[model samples]
Target: MQTRTYNHVDYLWDDTKAASLENDEVALFLYRSNILGSDLRITNYGGGNTSCKTIEKDPLSNKEVEVMWVKGSGGDIGTLTRQGIAGLYTERLRNLKNVYRGLEHEDEMVGLFNHCLFDLDSKAPSIDTPLHGLLPFKHIDHLHPDALIAIAATKNSKKITREIWGDTMGWVPWQRPGFDLGLQLEKCLKENPGIRGIVLESHGLFTWGDSSYECYLNSLEVIEIASEYIEGHVKKNGKVFGGQKLESLPSGKRIEQAAKLAPILRGLCSSENNMIGHFTDEERVLEFINSNDLEKLAPLGTSCPDHFLRTKIKPLVLSLDKEESLDNFNATVQILQPQFEDYRNDYKEYYEGCKHSNSPAVRDPNPVVIIYPGVGMFTFAKNKQTARVASEFYINAINVMRGAEAISTYVALPRQEAFDIEYWLLEEAKLQRMPKEKPLSRKIAIITGAAGGIGKAIAEKLVAEGANVVMTDVNQEALKETTKSMGKDEAIQTICDVTNTTSIEKMFDLSCLNFGGVDVVIHSAGLAISKPLEETTMTDWQLLQDVLVKGQFLLAQFGSDIMKKQGLGGNMVNIASKNGLVAGPNNVGYGTAKAAQLHMTRLLAAELGADKIRVNTVNPDGVIVGSKIWEGEWAEGRAKAYGVSVDELPSHYAKRNLLNEIILPEDVANAVFSLVAILDKSTGNTINVDGGMANAFVR
Candidate 1:
């Protein structure tokens, strides 16, 4: 590996920095990780730690003191949440280095430490708590950055470090990285007296400062310099292989197979009964299946250790031959059984060898990695997000392994050590301490025509309220572009023609597979046939019914099926026209179809009541910006029919309302969200979001 150099100032002062920090703490954590993770600088999965120290006045001592909010064990920085930061007693952590034989049964000592502390939760402190506690600064960050790791992994790591950081930085050789590593760091700090940071050989880097921002910036700066130096010097002239050409699978068959396979895979993974929708993307499955070099390259693990908890250590690689594929999958599992057994035995041996009275053994060494020849990967996570994280890690790991293979050979961590880390009792305890209820965290939603107008507003609103929204529209480009601005993890986009049974089934199936099950369905996809009754042909009537009436029926039917099976009463909001409730002169087909839709909503609500599926409708009057009915040729026709210009039509409609204000998509979305979130008792109801248009009495 060679070294490259770049200016840290470029990234540090970028405008997005402040915004990334100011958002939810979790978002900030992930954003910082993305910057550093992409650069391979400070942390990789479970290897590094970060903390923000806040000053609190000690009531007894009547003096200002500090508590370090540090990254908890068992959480990945790539997807760290606010709860992942464990608050620790800083004073006690700094004191641990002075004690003799600090290495022996440190897990027991942690309990004692926690007992002595104040305001700390029952969660287990991170193994790096002592390191965090000892830092004099208000903020501290540490990571096993890949650039530094590559250098540390080399034979001349010490020499390389001396050349780069010189006497001001301390260097520690690799040690089993919990309590012992903390003690080693303390000793290094003592010897160096006033060093800025420490670089652990075959591990990572550490940096701290007076504030959280300062510490984060310093770590980024150092890592940037390290990365730049490596890239500049490293002769990465090896062939850069292009991604595999995906063999085209029949889209319809592929989707059907994916839908069929999702539940089985979800059950096998032991996911919560409601979360099957998260794994159901046919496109994603196809992408995984078509990726090149599955047989030779699929078993490599994640870039970081914690990813193993989600994605497992290996994928189930399926073969082209059906019998051979099943045989290979079974054989792989059989081979893995011994490895798992041996891992558990060794973990027990390690725990027994230590023999700490306070230390408890963790969960068993179940196989984290599985392989099948022809089928793509299946990540087993307790929830949908974690599963997705695991999938991404696996994909990245495969790429890394292929790259490593091109350069040299792929070497994984020893099984015993891997098991020790994976089953660390302290780590498991940290996970248990996380809040049990996330309110609406895992709820699944489907928002039709979400590329624009009311659909987009509703989708955005649901997403903000913690629902994972699957957005769809017939305008594929628009759908993709619309969701591009939204966060990728919680939102997905698909091209859907709701009138078509195949499309509706595929969409519903995809939603269930990816998210577990559906909780809410907001249908905003509809067409308006504005021609006179005499001019409205049978074809026009059918088209209107297909999009407006049939679409709602199919969506409600599928949604009810999944919701009933999950036993969680679901909410369905149909977007009907105010014209449907009142007679309109020229909108014969549209009005008639929407009226049927309104009646259908009531009928479905009655039918699905036994299944705990609630159906309702939102009737909005007149034009809203971005609605197809409001834009294009339809608006002009409506304006002409009403004897007004296109611009005056909004006011004409608003004047008929009680509020005398034009209705917005957000207005309608707000009503829908309120209904879905709160109005469980009232189903088979139509809520008019027309700013009092129902009072017009112009019939």
Candidate 2:
């Protein structure tokens, strides 16, 4: 088993000194919180709670009183500020430790807790406040760390906890969180007076110390110990079977794809920042791809609940043949329909057995796990960090499950129990507290000329905003290389000859066959050749028309056809040059073709309107450095025509715009995403993304 000792936690704590706390301590707390928050191991927006207790003088009583400052209920740790912490009276909590028997409701216990508010506007105390209050140590920390939860989630969790932490920690089985869990701990503490910390099975870990740093360190140490124990005893062993060679996929394209797919999965999982991870490890890849039990393994729960938030319940397992793999994946989701219905029925029966009439019904019963045969697993989260944290836990959980299978039959959590936890009121409440995200999850988009600066920027921005994008370019090698820079699963690279009808058709077909369907299409692929009107030839016009005019028509045709069949309204944005709107000197073929594109946009919009298809144009002025037109020979001529050096053109163009800044591809892409994803009422309109160049008669 691989192991590394983290003295950083020790350093993290040593640096903080209550009032004399060094800057390092403050920085460490912030850093740790940010990291943990991002990972969804400790917190989600404002889920888990942390606290620091110190002795303060009571002015009226003239006596030292113990006080605790716990995390407020509603603030996200990702954006947490110092003021977000709430000061609560620790002495009152300590006094309530023995009086656990008759607690009926949580509100009745609130009067027993005290706090000094720094800000009156802050929300109510965290639900975990009582647990933090009851701990004896001065500094208390709690997190739903996936590593710890993975081990706790198993059937033999109590035995495993004993084997791992031995006598230093106490284990509490899954119980409804809040006052009940706190009461259980009170009972445990009465029995084992020396217990340093508590492990809430299938939930999280809690540790406390005399100071914030110590508490943080203890928490890390405990989690690291659990991780090490799992790695040693429960981790999966043996190389992945099959002789497949693992090679690193390129980053840019894959990152773009990951960015695009991340949002879709996030939407499906009903969370944002859902984590997605790709594995090309020969052993792991072969083990997943060649597994005869793909269907059986795909429906398993994630390592922890938060993992479900990011990766969902499964991954889109893939094979060398993407089409077949996607088909298999969709089939897998389809096959789960009956199983999900059965599971829901079982859940309803369980609820009826245990719940009162006043209790709320269970949430959706869809399987969160998805399996892509050759691809790695994805974990859903409210955000990317949460997804990643879940992904890490899943990797570990798979290891443990494999190891347990090796040792004995690997029994999963009981279905009713899994359902209970999945629909737990506390977790559901967390969902309610989280901010809502955009609705374009699982939506696929295809952008041509994506290797160009404008294309790359737009592709990246769209993915970041939660759209799965397939980026295409005429340059095959460039397209592949660019995709390598993005993520592999979420992004796709295709060498598309937009002007060729066959190529365009194949590309669209592949997109549908691989993903579900196309939601947005941004046609940015075009050629620009500036020539005097008298000097321009028919060939020049045809080439321009083939790409700018005919290429767009084909894209619109295929996009509209697919969207119509899918019965969902979709949007298309055409990347037109400002020259399309107003004529420019010596721009004969380029301007005419672009003008044709604008007319096509209107025509397509009018024709496809009945199908709920919206068509729009983003006319950007100025050929900056990254645009395909400006990077090649055209740059030299445009610079000469403007009576300026190539280096000065960007500024000159910017000066012509009202914004006095160079228009970026991201700006154009933002306009396109808005038109496609959000703007339902506006169509057949030309949105000028030009810095103000369209209004400037002279540059």
Root-mean-square deviation of each candidate, in angstroms? 9.1, 7.8
User: TM-score for each prediction?
Assistant: 0.61, 0.67
Query: Candidate 2's residue-wise lDDT over 405-468, tens digit each?
Result: 4333334444455555555555566678666665555567899999877788778877777666
Model 1 TM-score, all chains together = 0.61
By summed lDDT, which 10 consecutive residues of candidate 1 come out lowest? Answer: 318-327
Model 1's number of clashes is 39
Backbone Cα, N, C clashes tallied per candidate: 39, 64
Q: 300-387, model 1: which lDDT tens digit per residue?
A: 4433354444554445543333122222334534544454456446545645654445455544333333333233445545445665
Worst 10 residues of 2 by lDDT: 271-280
